[model samples]
Target: MSDSTVEDFLKSYNPEVRQLVLKTRAVVLAVIPDAIEQVDSPSKIIAYGFGLKYADLICAIAPYKSYVNLIFSQAAQLPDPRGLLTGTGKRARHVKIKTATDIESPGVRSLLEAAVASMTH
Candidate 1:
């Protein structure tokens, strides 16, 4: 996303949701500091990836009025021994983050790590 677009998107959400989204962004950046961040306005999401393609996407942050969802694209291939992931989609899975604590929960970091590691640079 362009700097203005991302700023506008972040400005649209409630403080709680904004906080969760930023927290997720921090985690994603920590995991892949060079990851590209983009906005999908139609889908209402901020996606993180290595390159400029959907196939290169690692995950996304979808914010709602009350919470934010951390979405993993290749969820089925990721190892989640702590079972932090939840969703019924064929390929994607999400972790609903309602609080800052959710971002620091068990398996969250590892899931992000594993997601990055699963990819071939």
Candidate 2:
């Protein structure tokens, strides 16, 4: 789906989640200006594309009551040289953040960059 589609989906989500989704989108935009947002997924996930070549290597964000979830579609493929992320679920992996403060960590920035690299050219 296109960015507008993604925004619409988020708009329909629970208010708490919707707010976090907006914040997450802002975070992604700050880092990757050219990234595209798409909500046209049957899986209920939002994707941020780094470029056409790396479109699938996404920064996926979802929300919960207590905290927001930021997922790296290619987390399994990232170097993880610093072991900053932790998740063992099938299909995808993620780094959970209890507060927006967590997003400011240097490690998170590196992870974001690596996530983008893992997907596209």
Q: Which candidate is the best by TM-score?
A: 1
Question: In angstroms, how far off is 121's CA in candidate 2?
Answer: 4.5
How well is each residue in 8-114 modelled by candidate 2, as lDDT tens digits? 77665667666666776677777777777666456666667754344354777766666667888667777766676778865467777676677767777788877
lDDT of each: 0.88, 0.69
Model 1: which residue pairs collide? 1-38
lDDT of 1 at 11: 93
* Distance from true location, Cα of 5 in model 2, Å: 5.3
Instruction: Please provide, for model 1 over 1-121, each residue's C-alpha lDDT reduced to its tens digit, 9 standing for 90 to 100.
Output: 4667776888988888888888888888888888989898899999999887999999999999999999999998899898889998988999889999999886898999888988764
RMSD after CA superposition, every candidate: 1.5, 3.4
Off by over 4 Å in 1: 1-4
Sequence-dependent TM-score of model 2? 0.71
